[model samples]
Target: MADPTLSRRHLFQASAGLAAALLPARAQAKARLGDDGLYTEDWYVDSFLDLPEDFAAARGKGRGFALQWSQRGCIYCKELHTAYFADPAIETPIREAFDIVHLDLFGAREVTFLDGARLTEKALGQRERIRATPTFQFFAEVDGKPKEVARMPGLLPRPEFSALFRYVAEGAYAREPFDAWLGKQGKG
Candidate 1:
């Protein structure tokens, strides 16, 4: 109807203007890590978050649950948290199973464990070869030692991720390799 080129140009200009307006907001959301190398508030969303202190007594005494690593600037991690961890569909199982700790892969803060050893988040990330954002590593309590049993890198669609979390939480990894266990469940 009206001039098509003119309409297309106007659309492009509007889209560019919107992108410009969003730039500052995105930057603000990705504020620099503090001197400690962690977000000022690593707490999960809302008032339901648990304190790491609650897991203090279990340190080194037994094989306890630990989530691998995270960084604030990672969009996939944000979506993973928002879409999976925060969703009621999966949050209940995670809360019941693991003592979740949000670690900044590049942060310099001291991470105090239940056993009382302190290390930086960067050190831990390096130990895990964390080359990607939003990696989920599972640990098994074998003879009271925490052994890395399985890991998932990147944001997985819910059903598979949920199944993996459940498998670990239920101690099914104790019986077999995660892939084999997943295969048994028809999800491998």
Candidate 2:
């Protein structure tokens, strides 16, 4: 017994509005370009450039930890934000699975590395061999200590990118390479 005055279109609009209201406020908003000339989402981790501490915090939250290396004037980095991250299907799960600390690949911001060495972000990037913009270096507990477990050196297509997050968060890397894991999932 539907109300004759309440048309399906009105009902649909009401439902959509309710859904939007129920979502986290930030979830409905788009990613923003920061003053540093990088695009940042509300969900990205706000860190103090202490790599080891940040990793511990991420682990405390039952999440993976990663460094997102990007430079100011990189087009691929922009696309990673504007295109891939703009889609909730790709961004939501990533937001859920990891605490991402953004770093400038060429900036002089001081960062404390896991080995207790404090160095500029640029120097650390060089030490880690992060030569390009938009590299993701994921870390996890390895042999009872925090160590880099996997790395994505550049932007990946949406599907593979999402799968890469899963590969780390689910501890699938210890079982197999990403390609083999993806192949088993029928997305390779």
TM-score on alpha carbons, each prediction: 0.62, 0.85
Q: Indicate which candidate wins on lDDT.
A: 2
lDDT of 1 by residue, 1-188 (tens): 76656677798999999999996653334323445433322333221113235344334343345554667667776676545654556756665556555667876766654344566778767866888877876666567655666787877788888888888777887788767777888544
Which residues of candidate 2, in runs, are more than 4 Å off? 1-19, 22-28
Query: Which digits, one per residue and each the tens of the lDDT, describe model 2 over residues 1-188?
Result: 87669888999999999988878654446668999888877778888888889889999999999989999989989888888887778888888889999999888989999878999999999999997778999999989899888999898888888989999999998999988888899644
Q: lDDT scores for all predictions?
A: 0.62, 0.88
Check candidate 1 and list the clashing pairs: 36-109, 37-108
Candidate 2 residue-wise lDDT at 170: 93
Name the TM-score of candidate 1: 0.62
lDDT assessment of candidate 2: 0.88
Instruction: Kindly report which residue stretches of model 1 are placed more than 4 angstroms away from their true locations once superposed.
Output: 1-64, 112-117, 186-188
- Give the TM-score (vs. native) of candidate 2: 0.85
The C-alpha RMSD in Å for every predicted model, in order, reads 12.7, 5.4
